[model samples]
Target: MSTKLHSAVEVGHLRKVRRLLTADGANLVNAGDGLAEETPLHLAARLGKADIAEILLDSGADPQLRCRCPFVNKFDMNNGRGDALHIAAAFGHASVIEVLLAACEPQAPDADGYFRLLDLTAMYGHVEALNLLLERCPMDVSVRSQALCFALEHAQIECARALISSGVDVTTPRRLYRPDGKGIRPLQFALSPYSDPCDDHILKTEEEALELVKLLVEAGADVNANATIAHRFGRYDGCDEVSILSCAAHYKLLKAANFLLASGADLNAKDEKGWTALHVAVASGNPENVRLFLDAGASHQVTWNICTVLDNDNYKFTKKWTALDVIGMCDTRILDLRVSLDWKKYTLIGDYTEVIELLVEDGADIEAKHETRYVGNTLLHSACSIANLSAPAGFKRSEFENGIICMNTTIQRLLPTVAAFVKAGANPNCLNRFHETPLHVLLSGVMNAIETVSGSYKYHHAYNWVEEEEKPSIQLLFQCICRTVRVLASAGADLN
Candidate 1:
C-alpha cells in the first residue's frame, strides 16, 4: 500500500495520491518506500511533484521526516542525511521547498551544523530554490553567513551575489577551520589558488574567480583583510597578519591580484612579522607579481625588515632579510632554468632573469649580505651554493657515474646564470660570517655531492679494473666542477 502511494507520488498522480490518503484503509501519508525508506512525500519532493507534495503535506505528511537510506556521496545523500526539505532544495523544487518550509521548522539544519537548507541549495547552485528559501525562511545571521560561504566555495557566483545582495555580511568569516585554527574570509577563499582539498568543488577559472572577488570588494569586503590562517600555515612565511593582496601574491593568483591592486589594496601592508606583499611575492617566485607590487610603491629598499628566526638551539632572534636575499634563495628553484637543454643559451630569457634584472635596475644593493646566523653570505655565495645542490639524497656513485654526461651538460647550462651575477657586479670573493667565500661555498656543494655519491655501493672490487672503467666518469665530473670553479675565479672569485 505504501509502494502504491509512492508510485502515485512519483508519477505525479495527484488524484491517486489524494484517494490513497482519503480512503478508509489508506496507508499513512508518511509511509516509507521499501528499500530507500524514503517516505511518499520524499518521493514527491524528489520528483518535483509540487501538487502531490502539497497533497501529502495537507494530509499530514511529515516535512521533517528523514529517509533511512545509506550515506552515499555528498550529492547522492541529502547533506549526508536525507530529508524532504533537503531533497526539494537539492532538486531546485522551489514550490515544494516553499510547501515544506510552511510545514517544517524553517531554521532546521542537516546533521552538519554548517549545512543548513540554504547551504544545500547554494552548494547545488539552485538559485531559485535558494531565493525562495532565503526570502521565506527564518535564518539567523550565522546561518546566512554559512550560506554565502557555501555559495562561494562551490563557485556559485549568482547564488553568492544573491546572498550578498540579500544583506549577508560580506565580512563574515568562514566557519570552516584552517590549519591555523582561524576562519578565512570570503575574499580569502576566493583568492586562494586551490580550494580546500577535502571540498568536492573545483576551483573556478581565473576570470570567474576575479569576478567573485570584485563582487565581494564592491559589496564592502575589506580588501586588506588579514588572512591569519594563511599566516599560521606558513606556506609563505608565518606572518600572522597577511592581507588579501599578500595571499594573492603568494598563490600567484594573477587576475585576482590585479583586481585587488587596482581596487586600491594597500601596497606596503606588513604582517605582524614585518613581511609585506613584496616579500611574499619574492618568496613565491613570481617575478610578475613582484613587479606589480613594486610598480604600486612597494619599497625596493625595505631591506631592514626583520622576521623572527629560530636557531638550532630553538632560541629566536630578529633577523633582517631583503627581497634580494629572497630572490637569491628562490632563483635555483626555477625548474626551467635548471632543466632546459638551452637554458645556458637563454639564461637571460626567463622570469628569474627578469626578476634579477628588475632588482638590479631598481638599485637593489647587489652586494647586500644575507645576515642570518647560519651563513651570512652574499647573493653570489647563495647562488653558487644553490647551483650544485641538486643531487638527490642517497644517490650512489654508480648512478652519478651513469649520469655523469648529463650532469656535465647541466653544469655547462648553468654557467651563464653565474655570469649574470658577476655582470651585475656581485662581489664573488666576499666572505660570509664563516669566512667562506663564494668559491668555498661552491666547492663545498660539489664536494658534498661527490661524497654523497661516492659513499654508495662500490662499482669494483680491489682486484678488478671495473674501477678503471668508472674512473673517466668521475674524472669528467671533477673536470666540470673545476671548469665551474675557473669560471667563478675569472669573475674574481678567490681560489684560496
Candidate 2:
C-alpha cells in the first residue's frame, strides 16, 4: 500500500482508506507477515482507528498475524500473545478491541496468552477493554485470580471488582510480598496505610476503603485468616500470625475497623504479643481509634509489648505495657514500629496530655507497671543501667536520640508526659529490683535534675565524652536534660 493509504488510516480518513484498499487490493494491505515489519492493519489498530481497523480486517488484513516487533515483551513475549488484540488493548481502544475479537479466526489464545494482553489493559486501567477481554476470552479460576492480582498490583479497583464478580476467590490466603519487596494480602492491602510500590491508583475515600474491605469479607474472605506479614511493622511488627481486625487498628483505618467489628470480626483477638485490637489502637495513639475499640468491647486489661529506650542503647527492655505506658514510651502517630528490630518509632513527638488523661479517666491502669518477666527490673532501674547505655547508641536503646532525634527536640512533650504520669498517680518512688527510685532513673538519664535534687548522683545519662564546647547541640541537650529534671522534681519525683 502507498504512504497515502497508511496516512489516510493515520488521520482517520475512512472513505479514502476504503478507496485505497480496493484500489491496491488485498496483496498490499498486509504487506508482510509480522507487524514488527509495520503491517498497515496493525498500525491502524495501534492508533485506535476502529473504523479503519474493521476495513482492514474485512479486506483480508490478517488479525492472527504475530507482531514480530523486537519489543517482544510488549506483544509477543507471552505464551499465546495476539498481535492486534495486544496493540488495541494497550491503547485502550474498546471499539477496536471488539472488532478484533470478532475477527479472531481461531478465537482468543489460551488463558496464559490472554493474560499477557490483560496486563497491558489493566495496568493502563482500561476497564471497558478489560470487560471485553473477559467476555471474549473466558478464564478459569486460576487465570481469573492471576488477572485479579494484576489489577490489584496496579490499584485498578474497577477491574478488580470485575474479576471478583467473575469469581476470583479472595479467601485463598494470598500474600503479596516479603522483606525483599512490598508485600501484603488483599484484605490487608485495602486496610493498610502502606501502598504497593506499583500502585498508580489507590483508594480515595474512607467509604471506598471500607467498601473494599466489606466486599472482600462477603466474598468468603476470612477475617481471622493468618497471613505471614509481607514486611513487619506497626502492631503486627514482630508477629507473623495476626487477625484482620488488628491490621485495621494498626493503620487507623477507622471505617474499616468499624466495618470489621460489625461484620463479626474478633475485636479482642490476641496474637503472639497478647495484643488485642485495643492494644494496637492504643499503640497507634489515635485516641478516637482507641475509643472505638474500647467502645466495641476491646479490653483495657490487655498487655502490649513496648520497649523502654534508656539513655543507653544496648539494654533494650521489652516489657508488658498497658495502653498508658505506650503513651509514655512512644509517639501517638507511629511512623515506624520496628518493634521486632530497632523498635525506634522514629516519630515527631506530640503531646499526649489529653489522650493520657482520657485513658486514665477511662480506667487504663496509670500504675500498670511491672518488671520484665526476664529482666525483673522496674521501668526506672531497667532504664538507667550503665551497661545498657555504654554503647554509642547502636541498639537505639534510647529512642530519644537515634541519630535522627536529639535530646532537645523532645523536651516540650517530655515535661508534659512526666506530669501526666505523675498526675495519673503513677508511683515515682516505686522500686525496681535495684532499689532505686524513679528519681534515680531521672537523674541517671540526665546527670543532674534541675539542680533541685538534694544531691547529684555519681552517674549521668547524657554523654559526658562529647565536648559541650565543640557542638552547640551538646549544650542544648544539657539545657533540655536540666529542664526535664526540673519537670520531674516539680511533679514530685522522689529520690530513693
Candidate 3:
C-alpha cells in the first residue's frame, strides 16, 4: 500500500487502494507517509471496514501493529489485533466482533490493564459481547472491565445483569470502592447518590429508582448501611450521618419508608431538622402517610394559631374560644393579646360599619382588656384604631373613668379605626410598662410618613400619595397636641 493508500483504506475505498497497490506493487504492510505509522490493515480496521480488513489481513498485513490513533478513535475495517476487535465491539457488530475476538490477543491488557473490547461493548450497552468477554475471554475479569465505566454511570441494567450472572462478582474488588475507614463495595455504588449536580441519573422518579434499591436489598444488601464510599465521593460533605431509612424518608419513598420503618427504622428519629417521619408525612401533604404516622401512634401537638390547628387537639375546646383560653391563661403572650384584643386587630381591617356589626354579633367584650397591661382597650381599642369604636352618648364607664368618655361619634368619617380608638375611651394616652403612650406611636407614624413623602427613606412606592395640593385638615402635630391636652384634662393623665 502506498502512503496515499492509507487515507483511501481509512475511508473504505478498497477498490481504488487495491488498484494503486497493484500499480505500484506495494505490499499492504507499508506504513503511511503521515505520522500515523499505520499499515493498510490498521487504516481499514480504524475505519470499521470488515471486508477490506479481511482482504488486507490476507495480503500479509500485520494485525498486531497498534495504530497511531488512540484506542477510542480506532475502527475495524479488517480482522486485526489491538485495533480490529476494539472497532467491532465499539460499533456493536457481533459477527465482526466474533471474527476479531477469535483472531485478536484475548489476554492482552491495554494501558489500563483492561481489554479495550469489553469497554467498547459495555459503552454501547451490547449485552451479547459483554457476556462473551466476561464468560470466555482469557482476559482477567478481576482486572476492571470497561463494562463498569458505563454500566455504573449510565446504569445499563441488562448488561450489568449479564455481567453479574456470568460470575462477574457484583461485590468484586474493582475500582468502584475507595480505601476509606471501611471497605465499600460495588453494591453500594448502585445505591449511592450521584456525584454530579447535573447527573439526575441517580434515580429520576421514586419508582424507577426504588427498583434498584429493592434489587440490592433482596440481594442481602444493607438497607441502613452507611458505605465509606460516600465519604470518598464527598457526597456527604455537609450531610450528617444518614442511613437507608433516613435516605428513604429523605427521598419520600413511602414503600422504602415502610420497608425501613417495618425493619425497625426509627419512625420518630430526627434528621438535621429534628423533624420526625411524621413531620415529613405532613410536609409532603400525603394524607395516607399522615394516617400512617397516626397509626404508628404519633402524637399531633396543638399549634398556637387556630388556622394551623389540627383536629388532633387533646383539649376539646370550641374553635370560637377566647385567646385567654388558648394560651392556658398564661400572660406571656400579652402582645399577641393586644394585637388580638379586638375584632379589628384579629379580624381583617375593612369597613368600620361592617366590622363593628360583626364584632357586636360575635358578642365581643365591649370594655374588656386582653391582659393587665392592655387594660381599658377591648376590641374597642382595636376598633378605635380604625375609627370604628362606637358607643351610645349616655353609656357609663366602669372600665376606665366616669361617663366623660363618650364612645359614639361621627368620627367614623375620619379614617376608620385610628379615630375610633380615640372615640372608644382608648386613652391615646394609656402608657405601657415602658411609659410610651400611643401619642409616641402616632408621632413616630407622622415622622415615618414625612420621611416617606420626602424620599429621605425608602418607601414602598406602590401606593405613594403625592400631595397634589396640601389639604388643610388640622395639621397632624397640632391635632395630636390638642388631643394630649384634652386627654390630660379629662382623665387626669400624669403628664409630669
Q: Model 2: C-alpha RMSD to truth? A: 9.9
Q: Between 1 and 2, whose TM-score is larger?
A: 1
lDDT accuracy of residue 63 in candidate 1: 77
Worst 10 residues of 1 by lDDT: 337-346
Q: What is the per-residue lDDT of model 2 for residues 410-471, given as tens digits with 9 covering 90 to 100? A: 33345555655666566666766566666666556553322211111112235565334321
Task: Order the numbered candidates by TM-score, best leading.
Answer: 1, 2, 3
Segments in model 2 whose C-alpha atoms lie over 4 Å from true places = 1-47, 52-91, 99-125, 149-158, 175-184, 197-202, 232-239, 304-319, 330-349, 373-496
The per-candidate count of clashes, in order, stands at 0, 4, 23
Q: Alpha carbon lDDT of residue 355, candidate 1? A: 64
Task: Kindly report which residue pairs in candidate 2 clash with one another.
Answer: 35-38, 177-183, 312-389, 445-461
Candidate 3 lDDT:
0.43
Report the Cα lDDT for residue 298, model 2. 65
Cα lDDT tens digits, model 1, 208-270, are 778889999999999977865432122323224567887777666778888898888888887
| TM agreement with the true structure for every prediction | 0.68, 0.62, 0.42
Model 2: lowest-lDDT 10 consecutive positions:
451-460
lDDT-best of 2 and 3? 2
Candidate 2, residue 411: how far the Cα is off, in Å = 10
Model 3 quality (TM-score): 0.42
Best by TM-score: 1
